[model samples]
Target: MDSVTVEGRAAAELLARKTSLAQTATDALYADMPELTTRYGAVGRERCLEDIRYTIDHLIPAIDLTQPSMFTAYVGWLDDLLRARNVSTREVIRSLELIEQAVRNELAPDEANVVASFLRAGLDSLGAVRREG
Candidate 1:
């Protein structure tokens, strides 16, 4: 995998923490995005897990989160996929919110800032699509 670009630390330290926090985000999604859970049904956990991983592996990096060139591409692709899946854009936003909440509750203060930054950026990217449309 390409190195994570979250500012202020070794890529290894930041990237390695992703999995530790994944389950908390996952749990929050189950509680907070019930409609999404229902929409995906039997695959809800898998789908939610996938989202958490995508946020960490793709969205968390400074390259993906900070640069509009790459970030906009992710925004477009995710919007298309959600539309095809019949998932509301708001549901995704709520899930990102919950992920941030979970990170704040579970991580050290600085680490929480780092982790929540990715979720916030994702929520912002998704909202941008709505404004453009």
Candidate 2:
């Protein structure tokens, strides 16, 4: 087997901390938009947590392979899923931005950059979704 690349190691580290990172991102969302409670109710909070966790789960492979397209593709599917449920695109965008911040803060600088590139791609995809809306 090939030795793990730096990106691979970083991806593994991210996977190891997935739960913590997801919770942190979700907490940030709640802090930034306290009205989420009234707007989305209790299930909304759980959904946010699940979304962050799912995002991180999908992100790990993109980071490991250094493929932004993989992450962006997932973002496209996520955009559709959220839209189907009558969720605001702004919330999706905001949640992604928060996930990026949470990931960046958790990893070392170099590792963070690797992850950030994929995140930027996902964010760009989200931007296009907003524009078309």
lDDT of 2 at 47: 94
Query: What does each candidate score in C-alpha RMSD?
Result: 3.7, 1.7
lDDT of 2 by residue, 1-133 (tens): 1126768877887888999999999999999989888988999999989998999988998877778888899988987898898877788788888887897898888778877777888989888877887
TM for every model, in the order presented, reads 0.72, 0.91
Which segments of model 2 are wrong by more than 4 Å? 1-4
Q: Which lDDT tens digits does candidate 1 get at residues 1-133?
A: 3444434342244466777666777877777656655667758687767766676565445533354345446656776887787777776676668667766776567656765665566677777778988
lDDT of each: 0.63, 0.85
Each prediction's total of clashing residue pairs, residues at least 3 apart in sequence or on different chains, is: 0, 0
TM-score, cand. 1: 0.72
What C-alpha root-mean-square deviation, in Å, does candidate 2 show against the real structure? 1.7
Question: How well does model 1 score by local distance difference test?
Answer: 0.63
- Which portions of model 1 show Cα errors greater than 4 Å? 1-6, 10-13, 63-72
lDDT score at residue 60, model 1, on the 0-100 scale: 49
